[model samples]
Target chain A: MDFKKKQTEANLKPGDRTVPERKIPVPHRDISERAQEMIAAPYNVFIDWNLNPPTKDDWSKIVTKVSESSAPAVNKLIEDLGLTVEQLQIGGVKCYRLTPENIPENHRKQLVIVAHGGAYVYAPGIGSVREAAMFAAFGGYTTISVDYSLSYENPFPGAIEDMIDVWRAILTEYDPRSVAMTGTSAGGGLIMATILKIKELGLGMPAAIAPSSPWADLTETGDSYKTNEWLDNILVSYSGYLGLAAKLYANGNDLSHPLLSPINGNLEGFPPTILTSGTRDLFLSNTVRSHRKLRRARVPAQLHIYEGISHSQLSFDPDLPETREAYGEIAAFFDQYLIW
Target chain B: MDFKKKQTEANLKPGDRTVPERKIPVPHRDISERAQEMIAAPYNVFIDWNLNPPTKDDWSKIVTKVSESSAPAVNKLIEDLGLTVEQLQIGGVKCYRLTPENIPENHRKQLVIVAHGGAYVYAPGIGSVREAAMFAAFGGYTTISVDYSLSYENPFPGAIEDMIDVWRAILTEYDPRSVAMTGTSAGGGLIMATILKIKELGLGMPAAIAPSSPWADLTETGDSYKTNEWLDNILVSYSGYLGLAAKLYANGNDLSHPLLSPINGNLEGFPPTILTSGTRDLFLSNTVRSHRKLRRARVPAQLHIYEGISHSQLSFDPDLPETREAYGEIAAFFDQYLIW
Candidate 1:
């Protein structure tokens, strides 16, 4: 049955017009459309969707199973594709590179890595990778974009292992203090996960990390999930999320585990962090919860929530004023923490 | 005649010398003996020797003449005296009541008002009615303490102003945020002179202010005066400040003129401020210039200097945990701004 029929059967009472039925809004429909575009855009090819084509009866279960399976598949795909190394390496893993030819010499010494978002189901896509490169070139930093394994094929350990390899390779060459990591959406989730992993391995932390509209909690405990269901311009409904990608990524593991859901992670000893999100982003709750957790942990975290921007807005158009401001703030934050 | 020759004659040199040329730090002297007893023991009156009496050279010709005529004969005999006012009226111009019971509820509001140091002859005296009451009880606000006037009547604004009127009244109120204002030496010059007076005429800004090692420029421009003079502890050297205070608070008009000296009249719109000073208490240069100007301008100001603290030690007091962690950080700053 559709969600509406299920709700009606579960909650409806005969002759109870007084009890209003929850109705999905138009904005949610619009967001779903945008999400589809974001997922299907040409730049997304680098990320293996690892989707388990739609099935009948228990739609939710099917999607969850697929998401879990996709994780390892994403890992195998990365290997089978023979993704080329692009010069820059950290901790012995190949990190994609943006050339110094585009960036000024003074700024080239700096590096900014942009991690892609897919709730751990996808790799860094071309658009996000290019955006990272553009930001590095304009802001005077060498940029690396990582394309990690997704959930459907490889599941839990697949993405984590690939990311660690990439980080180790990069750390081998660059001073940890000179590096800055930033990401949006699922990409944001990975950036944080990467930090936690690096810290565990006794590696030096990056100078700073900026996670925009991060999905820190896969458990969906944030108030915004319910309050902003239809109000947000993007990720309006958790149906697609809780039903599909989240389930796939969990791969039968407890979704609340810190490694799987970093919002619950022990954030002590983390470097200064900056979080940015918009009121209209579906993941607003995730961003706020993460920021509050960081603050309570005394992690020197700063959160700047834009009034009305959507998820991934910063990378979508760097020409926009808000995007520039966000980027500038990130740069300034780096200037304070990361001395050349 | 110059400080250099006097220092040489006194046989004072830098670096852990047992006996310094200046009597301020007499070898084997209990530096805090009197202060400790005053702070520890309950006493109605307290006094300390070498409290760095203002020098005659600090007064301008006109101020010197006024001092000669207005000097109280009994002041020379008494080291220090403490009194509570039932109501002290000055020249029938401004009236203030001293009774703890009579102080209005609003006037009783907790607040600490520190007197500016300018070796007296400059800022308003304890007896000056408006300086104490208006700042303390006016506009439904309560303030306590006034540094008693000091100097050539015994030079410039004296220590009496700081000890008696300002500090005494302020002690009645003890709320930390309510308590504000400080001064360096020279009664710490006028901490409120800069922003308060202007604010009183409708330009008051800032709820609190801090002037560190001020230079309430009595001589106008003593940026680096007597740079090569005696080994000065509290100031760059004493010659610069001595010449300046003497030039500014020369006569009756000079002492009262808002521009020349603030000690004599009209201290309105002053906020709570803090000032810092040190054992060296290098006469005028350290406290007079920046602090007096703030008080004259009617800004709320305070000064808190360490006994052995050098000039501007508050800013560099990370070694002293209290000083470092409690320095006026953004949280304290927000306390003032957030209310408005």
Candidate 2:
């Protein structure tokens, strides 16, 4: 339908009254055409047209697809770095780990624990671990990537318990305030839950946390869950989140319980946190809501929302200026809060 | 009051049961010994203390004392910078202007128009104007400090009219997206009012806003008015905020009107905002409430509460790292959103 017809049908004021007609037209030739096309299309259609899904498959297919696709890349990256793999016992669970020997001795003193993401369904792989090792080396910090139990195998408390043990080991070895925890997606949720657990256990909180595109609320009540339904480019719909993994992780437990959905957790005294997400990411609301909760709890929190980027794009394209800038900011936050 | 005595009198559980005895070892240190001493003093000594009016003499003296003491410091730091100033006709009122040259060119070319703080009773002076110039220089934005009519001389719409005129001039000169408005105390309220006026006038929205230690609600519904009481070193007590100046600024206006209180303002579509204040600051509640309102409105907003810092300390002690960091973050935010 035409603009006027849609306005009339909706009983809304004319377009001129709502949004003034641009006196100076859009500069780019193609942009104007695109703008016109967008204005002509129904709002939902426009949203869907702009939607960019990173993975085009059902949840049942996701694990196998990711495992197969990421394996070769992970293997090649790990081989190129000549990293050594090791096993560590954490909270009575054996976790896989990797340490790069090329890292300078000075850098090996400061530890960075990487909690891999996949809504708690996947293990820390060669792809993410190699990147974490590279970042830790470059940033002059010793890094360990946790290969915790996934929801498909053990679920819920298994992952949480593994993380707590890893954290406890770190604390026993180094000052708690000097430690920095980070992750993306479900790993982000783990970071938040880890901090919450530390506080509840009366352990000293970490100096800082950086969770990118975090799946904060497994329950999915964020307005963006509904508002950015098709506009998001990654994690296409909340169904992959709230519908599938949430049930899998819950193991028939209450989804709204703070332990399952950290967004519902009382955020009174978490450490300084930095949350990053792209506007086109399906988990945008997860990051935004988490940031809001952290702020309300009087925790020093910083949130950076990139306008047009997609989820996990930063990790995939670390050289992009936007990605580098986002990581740089997160690193800077860690630098300020994480002091050994 | 001793915990054991209070618990016994109230027929409540003993403190040892609720709180571990190990935590109660330093009970006496927690009590205010100075307060106890004061209360135990002779009746004659107490009478003599009350007779002295706490060294300031009276309310008028208190206001004058603060204004006079703060002036020279403001002037020495700000006015000496030689910022470019102009007198502009705004809303049929004369408004002082600090031009682009006053700010560092490399920072950003955005404009920041400021309304000075004086509880709407005092006129803009060398101190506030200088502070604005310094802020522009440090913040890397062209700043126009409004010398709006004050309440003692001109009431209600008089200051609002001047602000509206200055905003009109800014709109005419720059793209609204390239401009941000800010203020401290009463000026903070004016910034909120200016936003409402601009919205009502159908002008484009600004990119961002930062209101520091704003006296948002003249009616003083903020719990700090009672709770902070003597603990707040500045604004000494709520009476100074609610009794005289609040009544004067209102000029019979509704106390809860968002324009007057602005803590109650409808915050839809306003620019991304950052608010800063100190825990002990008198305007803590104003900042908190404004933050809550902005969040409720779904406007991207941030609030930073600095521990132990008093009212306007960030501006006052710009040389301090914390102050510079806080302002630097604000400048960075404006850089991100405000495209020149």
Candidate 3:
């Protein structure tokens, strides 16, 4: 029996007194019949609001809270996805390894190393660092995210050193050219710095890198710090929030030191890079400038800027079309450069 | 052996001539010292631009293209997540079941049935229908999404009849009160109609219902269809695109027929409802009005509106914090009432 037709027939009877008028005086609405032709219509996609810059103290508090951010619920999320979660001590540094349950034999050697971002603080352990690598694993890689020490105590080069050590240890099992490195925000910058450090120490580089809205310059020096200031919700401005992160991580060192801010370092031989940012990201210039520098240095680089998004917001949601597009691009880039 | 200290000392040599000036003339940037105050600051969170509605034919083309939208990559996404994908025929109707690889014994009877949105036209197959049920599976239920007949061919009573048949078959296997129904856009509206039909037929009501920005009023009769016209990127305006979906599905039926538009249906016993929308959703009024009707009828109902988002954008991104928060809430709601 077609219950739908029966229901509709029951609801409407011509000239029947029982079909009541709308109970409330409904607000006036435009009818679809009046939809005039849109001549090259320009549409609004998302909220485009701005904010007043945060006070230094306010900025510090915000940065501190972010650094201390933890996702207690993420382990369950990883488990629910059925990925194998393992905690490994590499050269005395903590790293969480997420291996997809099954894959083609040829895809086995491919690995994606992630450095979790918390402005070089926060995300202090394996639990907090899971969100960053979840995307890479979901992108179909055996992913391992380094749980580096934060600047709250370790400070400056300490986080970078931890990542370098983890990388050095993992390189023994996986070919350098078969691996990819990725990070976001401070973690993004850390990947750049770690590459430079590895290069300086004469170590091999990964095949590719995907850095999402990297904080390349830590000295509050990019144009985005002004133009897109307060437009980005996460990192409001370099001067307010990021500068605090810069100082906390720098530990009173010169802000432009190559090891602390990779934007100031040489870019001549960097890995094939896929960089990302949003129009409203405070680190927009960091991405644009890095892409230009890599190109000028003859390093192959691709930049993907998402419209109407803030720093790393796309990275947070794996289910978003943009997130899939973003990570899918990264995966394809790796597939091109690596043996996968 | 302090690698961090050694790395920092080597990078910084005070008064060294090798430190280069910035390669690019960066724009004037703001400084942290001048963050005066944000006294009574109003934050802009979304894009609020307006546009003239598209011509009827142009609108229809766009809507048709969107309705025919399919996620070709979804099956891979599911397999990568390690969820078991199974297809079943229930009373000659097609359904795709995505069961978590390792569900606790107690949770097996609990199921979330999904009706995917595409104005009743999109997500055509097992692959296309994955997005609708991903959240339910993430909520730790054995999830199954119906492959209901599309309006493109089946139209009107055809799709709803298929749903009723599938629901009836599934109900025979699992308790109705342990099931929760969900959908978005046309799919969302379908769930409402299905629940009403089930109630009319004296079937036990599901534990809860979560409809994301449902198109409850297909009549172009809601206030948001006018106010949010051109503001919502996907829908833009009801007159432009959605009215096409309405007409195609109505198949000569009156727009206000309760089966065609569930807002006209009874809300007195809608099961516990959690309705979702965004400030930019064209269906904001549908969700709001539905919530209001359920409350007036003394039915337990809750509404969630994401700030600066438009129509199912939260649903589109699984990685989005809003997506997690949304499904997490649904899962929790189901947990409270369902015996499992």
Candidate 4:
């Protein structure tokens, strides 16, 4: 409480010390009601969260549990947005195609490929298609959601290969210039890796890509991984299942492999990218770092960080203004870049 | 700790409720030592901060005290950067001209006009010239530091008019297209208002403007005002001196007036802009909102947010990498837009 001493200490160069402790309280004003509630909710307060599933089968059950739980919201979103969803087999892989009631003239030729996020192992089927449906309903573009291979049985190259296969299949029907891709969290990370794989395979890049709250760095190397731990309501810490999932996805691969963590990849000639994350999002640093990487490569990139939401929470409820604003930024970015 | 019930609650619509509680701890990993130290510092833990100065004279005294205290560090920065500072009278107002040790040939014609940050009432003289020196030293461009009229004696139109006076004077000798402007905090806010006034007065826009952590909204309207209150080491809350300074600067005028808060101004055709803030910066939402406004107006804008920093704390030490990166972004943005 000695003001003068603390001020002097602040002016001094920081030295090594034991971990400093302080408690942060939820902001009661300025932010929206939904944001406040999301931040205030202890969504990741599981005491058993540190325990990883004992086997791959256990991980599959966890994925199923999450997918089943998230089904109602995806159904609600589809109903509210007046979108039709259908299962498809594309490139010999499972996929979901979402179509809006009317395709506007300008976007008639455009196709959006989406990679859905549930870390790397969860959110199969409809859960994996939620973001694609949102983009389709909001942007009026026919969207394809790739149900990439989960890490429980297939890892690393598996998800990346599934995405590339879908991209190649889409390219046969749609022009590459008219194609755009986007996803959230692990899906965000996967799409980035997919683009890298596409580049490696000499498959052209999409017109634009939006990686929202990407878990771009599998290694806990971003500033937010630490700063936003316990603060971000979801993905509360890399120490939880997120860490276990990162290892599961790596499956003995190097965490720093550009394919595993695209931020470390050669980003030169990457497509125009628009990134989204909230102030309290655990992947904010990931998004920020990715934006810098794109900018460093001289690629046109736009970063939109929402006020106080956490980890893809903007997509949590389609009714939130922040949700609309987040999508609007992405849609605008795409409209500017994506070819008809 | 009941994950199942909490998950259900998270899915429900957020309704009216009592203020929720949370306790955020400092991240021990993934961020720079300096960032960790700055975030962990108890610099703003002043029990007496809620009290404001009773009179304009008292406020002036506080300003002088702050300037005097900050002089040592500013002096160190000048010496470290090998920058030479001189007093100048431009447009019949006091200012400082900062010259780097060697002005590179390409930058000889480039002028960077800097407005320093101090909440509009503090950091007069050399303290006010620190940011200009840093920009000049790092960017290798000759810079002018505006010693604008303070709110204690002159408010509202006073600072804006002074900036315009200086701009008009600079325009007589230097091509506006060859010039760039940068500032932090109030300086950030002031430069923005100045640009709006420049547009109103038929003066051509500068090549680019970099507003680092601008205090663009005077109404305490941004989400970070509450969310980053105590978390941001500097400008801990709006209820303290910052709130008083806001009122003093507004001088009883509506805080929402376009010139008072330039985010509300017509930013159409505004020059290329680069904005910088930090994850923990109180002015982060201000920067984010300003970027959105500029983007909405179709202005070329880029936003760079540091991992874990507070309001204008990047300017505190020129030795810090974040400081270098922040200025580098501004410099690169200016270089891309400014005519050689």
Give the top-scoring candidate (DockQ). 4
lDDT digits (tens) for residues B218-286 of candidate 2: 775653443233333345445544346666767788867877777676778778888876544557667
lDDT of 3 by residue, B106-134 (tens): 66788888888877755567644555456
Count of backbone collisions in candidate 3: 17
Per-model TM-score, in order, reads 0.44, 0.49, 0.44, 0.83
Which sections of candidate 4 miss by over 4 Å? A1-59, A65-86, A100-109, A168-178, A199-203, A237-241, A251-258, A266-269, A335-340, B1-62, B65-86, B99-110, B171-178, B196-204, B247-259, B264-269
RMSD versus native structure for model 2? 19.8
DockQ of 1: 0.01
- lDDT by residue for model 1 (A143-200), tens: 7877665575667766677777876777778888888888888778878877788878
Decide which is better by DockQ, 2 or 3.
3
Model 3 C-alpha lDDT per residue in residues A94-158, reported as the tens digit of each score:
88888776755666788888888767755666545555456545677888788888776678789
Q: Tell me, by TM-score, which candidate is best.
A: 4
Deviating ranges (above 4 Å) for candidate 1: A1-52, A55-94, A100-108, A123-125, A241-243, B1-204, B207-340
TM-score (C-alpha) between model 4 and the true structure: 0.83
Model 3 Cα RMSD, 1 decimal:
21.3
Q: How would the docking of model 2 be graded?
A: incorrect
Better of 1 and 4 by TM-score: 4
Pairs in steric clash, model 4: A24-B24
- What TM value does model 1 have? 0.44
lDDT of 3: 0.65
lDDT measured at residue B323 in model 4 versus the true structure, 0 to 100: 80
Docking class of 1: incorrect
lDDT of residue A268 for candidate 2 = 85
